[model samples]
Target: MKWLLAMLLLGTCTTALAQEATARQPEPNTRVPQGVMRYAPSGFPDRIVASPAQDARTGFSVAWRTDTTVGAPLLEIVVAGDSPDMGDQRRITATSVALKTENGSAHHHRADVDGLQPDTLYAWRVQGDRTWSAWHHTRTAAKASAPLTLLYFGDTQNKNVSLTTRVVREAMRHAPDARLALYAGDLVSGGDGEDDNEWGEWFEANEVLPTSLVVAPAPGNHEYFEEFEDTPQERRVLGAHWPVTFALPGNGLAEAKRTTYWFDYQDVRVVVIDGTSALDLGTAKAQAAWLDQALASNPHRWSIVLTHQPFFSPREGRDNVPLRKHLLPVISKHKVDLVLQGHDHVYGRLKSPPPVFVVSVTGAKQYRLSDEARRTMRPVAEDTQLFQVLRFDGPRLRYEARTATGRLYDAFDLVDGGERGKQLVERDEDRIDERACTRAETLKGRTDRCWE
Candidate 1:
């Protein structure tokens, strides 16, 4: 189960993790201490997560947490065949790190498994102190750009247990063979010190998805905080859990490291950015330069960029001008196909073509639309938790946005135009009316989620 996101591993998300620190007091936190302790790392491994290799065609990476008692945990992978058998399983060792957390001291292990055959089904598992997890499954990226399906999410920062879990489960049911599951950022609320139990909820919400698809994630502002609280040395730093939670490829600006990385699953290249660092920590210039370089060196037909902060906003007072200044120029220059983003906690997709910018939310949190969004985007929806399923076939990309209950809300197609970029072809046949806050809903004491 470690391989299947056995951590707080059950949930729903169709979003970009637009993790913004709202002025609202007391952020929504759904972590139950008992839940955290119930699955704490002991002899058994928890927080088991898998990330795609830099080149996913024939490789992948996995990470899991355990107690110190399991110093030399066992990892084995075998080509999925006739019956569950380890007779052909290949045993491998992992690099271990000791992580001290508020919950307790635990050991984290990472193993980058490569040299496997492409497009092959494989079963893997981890053995900790005294027990073993269920055999988890994963497939290597196809050797070439073939028909591919993927899932995208915004922030599930809050209400992962109550809301996001169902969203994730729904996505899996919707697209059983999705190769990659991309999270825009802010996977949890307390991406800081109080991060453990929150992550417990996240991992619990993400349950079996990790074992099957590439659990790709980017870091949102919430993923960082002043590690040293109430002290002179206090500074915004990655939470104690980020590094130990995921095994993302570190192929980006050294300053950003694992937080800002990318991977290629097939004919497409996904460039994930650390929007928090660019806007808050002054890594804008270098990060932008890197983006230009990443796209310039690309060998794929389409390039999609994923970031925690969006180039556009739906929340009235919120505008990420700084982020746009650094990131916009590069994305424009590259003619990227899709710029998927989160943070607005609302759904807004542009009516135009190439490099379509989409800001969506999958958690219970939803925001009102902004003046700018109304001016630039269409078919917008508010107060609706949504998920997106994207299908890439040769030169065409089908993008569909469905509500949490699986109702088609917005649908479109990006047709390849070669030098002209992708043409926006709307597919609203099954799309429903825009979902926004109603006066009746507001009168139900939901003023905070209205679109007045």
Candidate 2:
């Protein structure tokens, strides 16, 4: 019965989806940047991001941060309408969590809206004290599988305010219909509370991008901080802002919770693994067991996994051996459609029953390719920042890697053969040639060509 209800009504979401640019101030992207940034909590809310729930068909979530003075933050939402009376909205009090940061203490509020109609557009805003945020738009997933567009980005760890901002802007411009955007960790390099201002910069870089679509991020090691630095009893602690920043699905290992969770968006089952926990802490074996069961019970037609660390590391001599050892067998056996990752600031793609992509999308940081990466990862790149555009239509998935300037860098297609099995076929005849260290002589080396 649940499977039958999963049938969706959206044909091509890229066409029907609403862009946040409409009816807003004459700003270029979606929202204008506010001057005089404040890391400490203010009277109003900031750092607002929406996330797809465990079952996106009927529900979705949005999280925001505010000062402790704003008691009982509220979310106001209504089915999208052109009528000026859209103010007739439903209100839900938010759940708030308090924490002390390097700057000052603040409250992170999360509000989950359930029982919404699938594939419907809705305008929402968060109220803090007496102030309310300008309205933001979001759409729910279809009741069943249909044509969907997704955007994936690598690390946006450094210089988010100046460098990473443009990359994110280009991605939004190129794929305005993308309903979901996943970032493979290292979102903010300001580990723990040492520099919570990076969190403010990150949110500032994207503007309303988080509120416009689902910005589900996989926690990178940088998201963890040492509570007691320079001490013998020092141990790693998850960033206090992580849970407050995202209100993701809770169907994951209780021990890992938000960092390791899964969600079904449209026809795709998306799973996020905590490589930081798997490698840094010691949850590989436990995660492997959970992953096996998670993949085994997948009811969606296609499945993909996201993590900060790649199974095949792209950086020289930097490999996540434990993650590969414990989880590789299960992933290969299950034959997942795709594994999206970021950690090494390089781009590499491999072909197989399940293709893996280690990509970066920040101009702030770049790394050299590994010798093993050179031999194993064809259609590889170094010193290049990129974002991937994915379109899913029934059994076929179209994937494209676009550079920071919105130029096509790599392309491929994954066809689900149902009975025969999934096959990866190249579709990059027009894309620029492979980028690597060897091409320095012919491809202009460090001048224009990458692989530096």
Backbone clash count, each prediction separately:
31, 3
lDDT of 1 by residue, 139-171 (tens): 888855589999999888887887898988888
Q: What would the TM-scores of all predictions be? A: 0.88, 0.86
Q: Which candidate number maximizes TM-score?
A: 1
Candidate 1 regions off by >4 Å? 1-28, 31-36, 191-193, 227-234, 439-452
Kindly report which residue stretches of model 2 are placed more than 4 angstroms away from their true locations once superposed: 1-37, 192-194, 227-234, 436-452
Candidate 2 residue pairs that clash: 6-144, 7-144, 8-144
Residue 163's lDDT within candidate 1 is 85
Per-residue accuracy of model 2 over 51-88 as CA lDDT, tens digit each: 99888877889898888897678999999889867868
